[model samples]
Target: MITNFLHDNYKNITRVSILDAKKVFYPMKYVLEKRDILIDDDSALIILPFPEDIKYPSNTKMTDAGMLWDYKVEISINNQSALTENQLMRFLNKKVIVVFHHNDGKIIFGCNEMPLQYGYSEDNSVNPAAHCGYSVECRGNSYYSKVST
Candidate 1:
């Protein structure tokens, strides 16, 4: 099977700073050869969404590979942070991903020949507690007929 096995080639891995509201991060690493995601290896991007954290997938569009689904994840430190205003503002424009919680089984976006693209946001804001955060939306397009995990 073909895979993107180039070591340390992901550019998105360089945008981590503080924690979100739930102490998790986004846009974890995707190892092609392993067919698995590296959530907590060298980064703090383990976004295990809670049952209520799973939001709706919006902005449907057709892709050459398959259907592209956009997922919005609200990440805010709010009252759970210690970063300065400028430091907290760095979370914007960073890549993110779509997350979900499944007890029956685990779900993986995209497929063998194709992987999801990192998502970004248009707007970000700070809370009353002087924390910065925004809604990051990522897209996943499957190559096959279904979104196989």
Candidate 2:
């Protein structure tokens, strides 16, 4: 079975919408980072049935009995000359529903339920024109499905 769903479709995402507003379209050169964690699984081990006549080693089975569907996502921003540090501070701290849209599907996730915070880029000294650069982390249910384009 092919379980690597996110790997096969990450690039299809074309936009990200925060609630009903704040849409960030794709192909933006300023996207510093993007990632998704899918299929976080935990399984139980079961002893396998063995033949009496054959002297075979004991075998075990892996069961997807307690699989966890908790998904996580991270998005980083960079080089936003139009946004100021103060503005970014306000935006990053709010709780909002984030919608990721792809050519073949979409996923909506929650952020800031525990409060979202933004961090400065590692190399912050080079750009001094209030070039907006920050990172956001989000977590949500892992259940997602593709839709017709």
Candidate 3:
């Protein structure tokens, strides 16, 4: 249900843009991957591989109060894009606002806590159409609702 909730909520996001310290625009592509969802009872909990021995307590009450769900979004840079990998890293590593836009609405995912870092991909020197990618972890307390156009 969590994965479906994320996909249904964000699947419409068609664009990702960042505003740097100098207010420069750097648009990037988001390479789709099966989104990783981790449910935690605490807001400060870091997600880890689910433990096999862990069992859900039957008497547990459901509340969104301190619940936190982390979604790992993988963004990419297309070779044909106007921006380069170097250019992206320069501003992305610093404080910035990452905006996700869809046809109906948008979400301003605050990057103040989630700092983007460089990641590796297979060499595409031989291939003419390969994309470079980076990982970004976005945290949210409540599920997003789809807005009406």
State model 2's lDDT: 0.34
Best by lDDT: 1
lDDT of 3 by residue, 26-100 (tens): 221110121322222222111121122111111222344322323333453334333444444454344444445
Clashes of each: 0, 0, 0
Question: Residue-wise lDDT of candidate 1 within 29-90, one digit each (tens)?
Answer: 23222243333423334443333333434455676644455533343322323343334344
Sorted on lDDT, best first, the list reads 1, 2, 3
Candidate 3: segments with Cα more than 4 A from true spot = 1-9, 20-65, 80-83, 111-149
Give the C-alpha lDDT of model 1: 0.34
Deviation from truth (RMSD, Å), model 2: 18.8
Candidate 2 lDDT over 1-149, as tens digits, reads 00223643455555544431122222111111223312111211111111221111112233343222344445555534544444444445444344455555544443222211222332254666743444444443322222211
Assess the local accuracy of residue 56 in candidate 3 as a C-alpha lDDT between 0 and 100: 15
RMSD of 3: 14.2
Tell me the TM-score of model 2.
Answer: 0.40
Question: Candidate 3: which pairs clash?
Answer: none
Candidate 1: list runs displaced more than 4 Å. Answer: 1-35, 47-50, 75-78, 83-92, 98-101, 108-149
| Poorest 10 consecutive residues by lDDT, candidate 1 | 9-18
Better of 1 and 2 by lDDT: 1
